[model samples]
Target chain A: MSRVSSKMALAVKCSDTFNADACMHCGVCTAVCPMGIEMLPRKLFRYVQIGLEDKVKENISTIYSCLLCGMCAENCPAEVNIADNVRFLRKYINENEFNLS
Target chain B: MPLPTKDILGILADNLNQRKSVLPISSAAATRWAKGLDLPKGGKTVLYTGHLYQLIPIIDAMSGQMAKFEDSALTKYFGLGRNVNKFINMTFFMGMMASKDEQKDYDRMLRNIALLLKKADVDFGYLYGEELYSGALVYDEGVDGSFAKHAQRVADMFKKNGVEKIITVDPHTTHTLRTVFPEFVKGFDIEVKSYLEVLAESGIEPTNQITDDLSLHDSCVYARHENVVEQPRALLAKTGAKVNEPRLCGKNTHCCGGPLESLFPSESHRIAGNRVEQLKEAGGSIATMCPICLVSLRKAAKGSVKVNDLSDTLAKAYGV
Candidate 1:
């Protein structure tokens, strides 16, 4: 599962606004979620960073279910834009899976 | 089973693209709250509701209906509903499900906000029916293309109305208009302030002594996104009320899960229930600054905690 796909690598490229690479596997985001969703800004971003597209796919609902309330971003030690990363993933899904503009 | 995210978001995106509101509502129903308020139309500064308070009851009714359909076979029809919605507005049926009393309660909050502004002698006008929804839902949901077009429309409407400054009633509207709009709409330069911020600046002294103990639920959008944490607290303090802080509050505030209401109703309710427990421990009537927070927390509170719009508390204190 650690085998990286150049395709997946391309998909998760760091942008000026979105940098999951800045995450340091901190569990603060998971602890702070109002829903107590565990695969949030921490595990999800870790998945993205490792090019685990299948893992990201399995948790698509978890991504959409986020309140985007900024709690995770506030508590993050690495100062990652956790909410924006979730949104970037959503946009990726919308464009790829749903074919939405 | 996974949720049909594509279908649900498709319906919302279609509605926004076609109807200009996430839910299709008549302009009369949208602007009915401002009736008899005699607000001057089109001014340099305006009270921009963003139709957030006005649309809450419909959102509640629509989401309540959708919640019933969540795990059922009827979920298949969401795609069909989206197709039909392109021509015929299915949300009208949903809008009819909204409780009149709930509508009145939310509308009363907006009225109280306006009255408080009046009491402060703040010079402002209203856009009335011309006001648009801030596209906060689509933006948050990452329906960027639809949101961008809708944002441009809202910005153009503001420019047409000569609105240099706007006093937004809720945090979602404030954050969207103030922060997100600039990115989507070129030259979007509207000065956006939440009513609480405006009131805090106005410094209207409380007339009636408020002795009620209040637990304040800070909106995540206000607290973290827009830096509006202190403004609401400051306004509440002016009422001579003792405001209790929940364990998770201020910049570290917990979400009410209102944002998930559209797609994940059951999970949304579960999260709201959890936040209500923490808020209830604060020991008093609960106050919320956002309509989404008011509705989400009130449903979880179930009359046991007495959730209220913060404006209502301020209305009583300032004798508005």
Candidate 2:
């Protein structure tokens, strides 16, 4: 039942802060995460990059659980803003799913 | 079985929107720390707590309740609790569970910051009861719309008070005021500095010497976002205390697992326990500059190692 929405992908790509595409999948972020959530910014960025809404939805609890401590973004050789990207997903979820705004 | 993130976030947003703080603390309780300090009301330069330190005990108490709820079947009722909280403010009862001694401990830390500023001969005023919570938790939780509105309100309050500069107490408040606020509030030109930064620049020599080793836990906001890494270290150095850096320090500092404390208590504690292990390996008494870090590490350490606010260590060295 899940289909990629170009709109969602476009919105995420256009965000200056959510540089998920720049993620190199090096696992540096996962190594540093205190929560030890295995996928974290690395896999989460991949989900965002491929426009896998279902994947992101499946990991919604994981998304909300991020510490957003910037430890990943700081250590990322790709210089992706991992924490801000997580914030973007949270903001996205808050708006689309929860209808907070 | 999933954490009730939506319910928790919704409740926090509602509180921020209505009460001007994520937690509903009375003005009297919030301002009790500044009593007998004789700090003036407002001026061009002011000390803005953002209630980060003041709200800690309540946050701790509520998190304890939340941990219990998470382990039991009561977790499902969080949605109903959120709805009920809209009218009754159930967190008020949670706030009652905050230990008086813990509240006083946090208050004393604020007092020490003030006393240290005075010792440095830096002139600052307090907003006292007029201060707002800076919407840090909502902002951190990605409740941007609520945060934006609250940030505007805070900026307007500053404008009304003629506050040109703000000296912040904790890292989260410092980062929000220094970096995040400017983005949300256009022309938000207030000069923001942490008391650590102010004291570092002041070259305030400590009145006493503490020849003890300490592990400094840097708040992620202060270390990475705010570029406040050296200020606290330099201030601590003046106290004659040698600070041992854990594996992750400075811009690469690890989180205290705080940002998730409200939404995911168990995960937060798990992270905190991990950080405590790293800090303990570094050897020495632990010193955390941020209130969240202090509480998190202290909870995880569980008296295995002494964890304290940096202010307590600095206050001891300053003989305040």
**Which one wins on DockQ?**
1
Q: Which interface RMSD values do the candidates have, in the order shown?
A: 0.8, 1.0
- Give the alpha carbon lDDT tens digit for every residue of B1-320 in model 2: 64588898999999999888899898888899999999988989999989889889999998887888776788799899888989987768977899999999999999999999999899889998889898988987889999999999999999999999899999889888888898889999899999999989998888899997998888898888889899888888777898899998889888888777887788888889989999999999999999999999999999999999999888899888
Model 2, position B68, has a per-residue lDDT of 82
RMSD of each: 1.5, 1.3
User: Local distance difference test, per candidate?
Assistant: 0.86, 0.88
**Candidate 2 residue-wise lDDT, A8-99, digit = tens:** 79878787767766666789889877777897978877878778888888898889888888887788888888878888898888988888
- Residue pairs clashing, model 1: none
**B-chain TM-score, every candidate?**
0.98, 0.98
Instruction: Evaluate candidate 1 and give its CAPRI docking class based on DockQ.
Output: high
Off by over 4 Å in 1: A1-8, B1-3
Chain A only: TM-score of every candidate?
Answer: 0.88, 0.90
As a TM-score, model 2 comes out at 0.97
